[model samples]
Target: MRHDSATLIILLAVVALIAWFAPDVVLIVFAGCLLAVALRAPGVPLARRLGIAEHWGVMIVALVALVALGLLVWFGFATLADQAREFSRAVPRVLERAGTLLEGLPGGDWLKGQAQPEAVQPSARAAANFALAGVSGTLGALGNALLVLLLGLYIGADPTLYRRGALALLSPGLRPRGEATLNAMAHSLRGWLLGQMFGMAFTGVFTFLGLWALGVPLAALLAILTAIFGFMPYIGPVIGAVPAVLIAASHDTSLVPWVIALFFASQNIEGNFLTPMVQKQSSDVPPALLLGAQALFGTGLGFLGILLAAPIAAAGMAALRVSYVEGWVEDPADTDEKRIIRPA
Candidate 1:
């Protein structure tokens, strides 16, 4: 109906407005939705096992999950702290060597005279500030973290409420189809998240092992960083590897090729083998479409926009397929039983 189409457009407009006007809050909501779904998978059986009320089970499960996450964060921070200390000790020597090497180049004398001293000072100060900012930005992230945790807790307690609430907004007769559509959406999202998580973990492990074999320092920190990047759709592997390669390059030029090969190889394995095997829930969307969505979302919103764009678009697609194409204009020749996903 025209009314439903208008409503869909309005809903999308509202979502886009929120994303544009309040990206940080939108990010928290996105993270909350994902974390809630993650907890939902393990919450059901445990709830029944403990004979607790569903809400109480949510609290317990959420508590356990949050605690586990806190520990992981602590461990990762500890590793990063160690790496930072090592960097503080080693960076000066690395820079000095780099300067020496630069000074020894064939055109070094000419380049040195051409290099402006004031420009170098600002660049050095900017680099120092950037490093400090990396460790000092926790206060800003805390609010986002709390928002995600609270939202996850509330949603995990009553995910059905959200599904039903959303379905209720559809036309009365379309509610059943909406439910099925949402299930498909949930399946796709959960499967994608699971696949990415597994792939990221495997990539991180691969990074750590390879770096260790090549005598790279801060391998643990680098591995964790790689895992974070690998979760991102397109640009993650390259972003994660840049610093790793830079650090290795600083130590020894010969290590550059080895590090590059290892990083690319691990990601290739994940992309070719692990991802398809695990992420079988959602059929692959066209890469061009995916890239376009990412570009549009990134341009319209920000980093998290790029992150959630694909799934949000997929959910929209699923809903439209069910409501308009499949559910609305039923084929007259089809019997009720034969209708299924085709047309009724």
Candidate 2:
């Protein structure tokens, strides 16, 4: 199909504005849809047990999931807020320990003389701030999140509506292949969500266990950080571990280096084995391309782009397979991809 220049420009501008205005909402909606996909299987059992219709059953589960998520956030934030207060009071000791440990490194002599970077202590701007940050975050954005939450419910409870609506809007010649693409895309998204949650739980448990064993303070709060960061796929390991290292550094100067190194080691293990293996059972997305997309579109879409990258790629894979392999369209340059579809 020939692309329209004006139309393309308009679309790009709209997308850019949306990305700028509401990145968080978009990612939340994407996440909610993914969660719905993951839970679709259990809807059947839930419906039977609750004596509700399929759609209602799905909504029930979705709300329950959202509520549970909210409660988890509430508790986690509360815990972190408490930790921050305690940590702030103990900042001098932590800084002294960190400086002592840093002095042993290659640049130790110069570093120990200087002050700890405020960077290590999360500033008001950083998300690691106290629950007090939530009020700032919600200022005018609460409505957007609520809208996305509602949209997610409608889409999740009966995704087929959107699929059919989208399929109907496609060119007649492309509808059959598009349907196939949607099916595959949904499956891949569902699998990715399942794998993601599983990976998060695994990471959280491992981090908590490691920190607790090492006697790190605020182990629960640190585990939550690990799990939340793990949402970003390959980038999560480092993001999750940074605070833990700093917090640990603050506690015992001698243990800082070991703690940092161990965090990296655990991340390596999870990336190389746990996450990939679980995700592989769901779908096969190459790590190189995943990271590349994260870097590229992430610049354009920020966190929303990063979160949606894998799902979009999964959809593209489905389209390519159904269009070329299933013979829905002809690839003029490659005879191998010529596909014929007969109307029913």
Candidate 3:
């Protein structure tokens, strides 16, 4: 018993050290797990219907998704390409207009000074370094994305293999509880993903309609961006709103407030209405906990950290409930009335 405990502690310590030293790898793995869950969500049902293996279903789903994405790009590429170019052109204009507007306000000169690039030009060496860094960053991002997709596909193909491998790490006595905790975590993650998808769809549709109504250019592009960004909670919506607000401000100063109001309304509806409705069927991760996790992970891991924070928090909460709360805190002997009664 003592040997098992010691082994578990050492294992945990080794895992923690790896996480601390190589957070990027950890983030990539977590992202792959998330993608696997997403693939499995549809794949499982399809497998049952088609009387095929789950892994085969997952493969089929992945192939179909890739084909659909290719078709979408083939069809929508021209319009999106045009809008993207227009968006790029509009950004500089927006910044210039913003600088002008800032100059008109009190303390605007100081703000503009702070906001603008430094007057001093960079040296050749510095310029080269900056360009190198940008290229490296872009390449690194693409590499990481490809790795994530491959890992996700591999894991989604045979999730049970990974599950059993994980269980193998635990003692025989603890494997059942560990498996239960893992299942709970998976359930929580799935729920969070489902809720996020719904929220993103809701935000996208409403944003496009509202932007179109308000005569915003690149409504489709902006809406797609907003939907994509909606995956990250708290900070995402705000970031998503920035391009639209900037474009609106540049186009017609009057449109800015309306654009802001539109996003505010959409976010409120999604947060207050859609999210709660979905949370009813899943574990409810507290807003404070989620925000705290975002802060911690974002500080440590940057953008990917923020993107995965909510689902991590959800899974963490689920694991706690199963392993700690239900395992020890709840008294099987106590009746509902007894549980509710406070000590005098």
Best by TM-score: 3
Cα RMSD of all models vs. native, in order, equals 5.1, 5.8, 5.0
Ranking by TM-score: 3, 1, 2
Residue 102 lDDT in candidate 3: 95
> In candidate 2, how many Å is residue 92 off?
5.8
The TM-score of candidate 1 is 0.78
| Model 3 agreement with the true structure over 166-232: per-residue lDDT tens digits | 8888777666556777887888787788889999999999999999999999999999999999998
Q: Which residue pairs clash in candidate 2?
A: 103-108, 327-339
Residue-pair clashes per candidate: 0, 2, 0
Candidate that beats the other on TM-score, 1 or 3, i.e. the better one: 3
The Cα local distance difference test for each model comes to 0.73, 0.69, 0.84
**Deviation in angstroms for 213 in model 1?**
0.8
TM-score of each: 0.78, 0.73, 0.90
RMSD of candidate 2 to true structure, Å: 5.8
283-328, model 2: which lDDT tens digit per residue? 6677787788788768877766776777666655655665555543
Instruction: Give every collision pair in model 3.
Output: none
- Sequence-dependent TM-score of model 2: 0.73
